[model samples]
Target: MDIDNIAAKAAAKIDAVRDARVNAVKTAAASSVELQEAVQLLAAAEQKYAKDYQAALRADWTESDLRGFGLDAPSKKAGGRPKGARTRQSKPANDAASEKELIGTTSENW
Candidate 1:
């Protein structure tokens, strides 16, 4: 009920929130790294599969022969944001030019 006790309680709450934010940020960064590794692995596997399929074709593989191995020798869809996914708003095209043209800009401009 005293001022010192109230201040201490508020400080404790703030510290708890700060710790939670730090943990959340760390978790997000770790997840991002894992996602990147997974994407790279997927790309490598796709590339290897394509190379193997091409080698099979060079060895005189027919469509039926490739199908027997459960692979279709055809062009594939490019990797990108999923269909119907909302697009992120990009910065205005002139943002860089405007920034450079700003009067008396310094390192602290941001």
Candidate 2:
């Protein structure tokens, strides 16, 4: 019962949970606008949850040099953490405002 093994088990459990939710949503869906919205919401929630789970997995890493989510662990020498990992650290930001605005400052020269 080491950290990596426990993590793998927990991830398997999480995947099961996600799959159940998706299946349930699919079963409940109808050819209606409301049903469509519900399905979209479920998909968005799953996507967000998956991303958070991956981040957590990375944060508490205790496995081999190779890294990633689920059962796949690729490396460069062997394909791990991917080359653009550092660049992926922050969101694209994609803002046109000045840095001050980004930090919630006013152009009032405060």
Candidate 3:
């Protein structure tokens, strides 16, 4: 066979293999909108789940409330109030240990 004939055959096979693999991935992924939906749904669920929890905390906690609550601990709003904004009187205590310890004991808890 001519060199071109041999090379052409090999190239065609390689292209076929590549096309097959691509098709396989596309087919499997396409097989289930539910699967895609489920993955997206999971991502969205996780995102919203975290957001919901944080939102709940934000609803209860206001800005400038990290001091008494401390900075090390997790916070829905404890990142030291948003920048460039004046703090309110109802701000969180800047004392982490003290603020965290005050949980469930403050008049607000009642």
**TM-score, per-candidate, Cα-based:** 0.62, 0.29, 0.33
The CA lDDT at 26 in model 2 is 76
lDDT of each: 0.81, 0.62, 0.67
The residue-by-residue lDDT of candidate 1 on 1-110, one tens digit each, is 69999999999999999999999999999999999999999887777777677677879988798899888874644344576888798778698677767744665586
Clashing pairs in 2: 74-79, 74-80, 75-78, 75-79, 75-80, 76-79
RMSD of each: 21.6, 26.2, 17.9
Model 3 misplacement above 4 A: 38-110
Which candidate's lDDT is highest? 1
Better candidate number, 2 or 3, judged by TM-score = 3
Clashes of 1: 0
Q: Which is the winner by TM-score between candidate 1 and candidate 3?
A: 1
Tally clashes: model 3. 12
- The window of 10 residues in a row where model 1 has the poorest summed lDDT is 74-83
List candidate 1 segments past 4 Å from native.
Answer: 74-110
lDDT of 3 by residue, 33-94 (tens): 76889888877666665555566556876434533464223333323347688866665557
